[model samples]
Target: MNKNFTLFNVLPLVIGWIGIKYGINWLTIIATTVIVSRSIMSLILSAKLHSSLSHLSETVRSRYRAVLRNPQLTFSVAIINMISLALWGQEESLIILAIATGAYFSVRHQLLRKT
Candidate 1:
């Protein structure tokens, strides 16, 4: 199994535990898990992409690099999570939004810095 994948699955259990301890609803817990998991995965993949760029053809490398640099996927996921939280009447939606935005920028910065 991929180390990143294993890490992705395992790290969220901590979030789940925190949620349970705090008595947070399942939906919010799930959303938090998704956001955290995606953020970690994106960063891991970005690092891997940076390391492997030399092995890829020019065209493929450029395209992959561009995709990694884009923040649209992160933004979309944040928007979806925000909308879902709002619809569910969760007050912590804003907190989630902040976290998602932070993650998005952090990942973008990492990719930009590496490349």
Candidate 2:
């Protein structure tokens, strides 16, 4: 996996580890859920819209990139991840979290318009 993506995936875990070490009730779990969920959403959106990405369409990629920058979008994804993690149990939660985290970094690499 890409180093950046791996870092993104581990972001929440790192925070959680820190909290665990310090004995704090940090929202790292919640944060992880959000980050992962947002990534899944962006990926789904990109796949739906990137019908011709094989040819390299900057426009579609740009739109998805904008989605990445949206706090609201990220928040929603995080919320969904949290709820899903709560109900689906640990394994599913971990998988989704991983996807979300990995995708978080992928978004930067896949930025459409390029900043």
- The best candidate by TM-score is 1
> Model 2 TM-score?
0.36
lDDT of 2: 0.54
> What lDDT is reached at residue 23 by model 2?
62
- The total of clashing pairs for model 1 equals 0
- Per-residue C-alpha lDDT of model 1 across residues 1-115, encoded as one tens digit per residue: 3575445444444554566567777844685556555655655665665566457676765565586576675466456555554554555545745554665466456545543
CA deviation > 4 Å runs, candidate 1: 1-24, 65-115
User: How close to the true structure is residue 97 of candidate 2, measured as C-alpha lDDT?
Assistant: 52
TM-score of every prediction relative to native: 0.41, 0.36
Q: Local error of candidate 1 at 27, Å?
A: 0.7
The per-prediction CA RMSD against the true structure, in angstroms, equals 8.1, 10.1
Checking candidate 1 for backbone clashes, the offending pairs are none
Off by over 4 Å in 2: 1-11, 54-90, 97-115
For 1-115, candidate 2 gives per-residue lDDT tens digits of 4675445445655555565567665455554465556557766764544444456456756676665665554445455545544543434555655555455445445564354
Give the TM-score comparing model 1 with the true structure, all chains together: 0.41
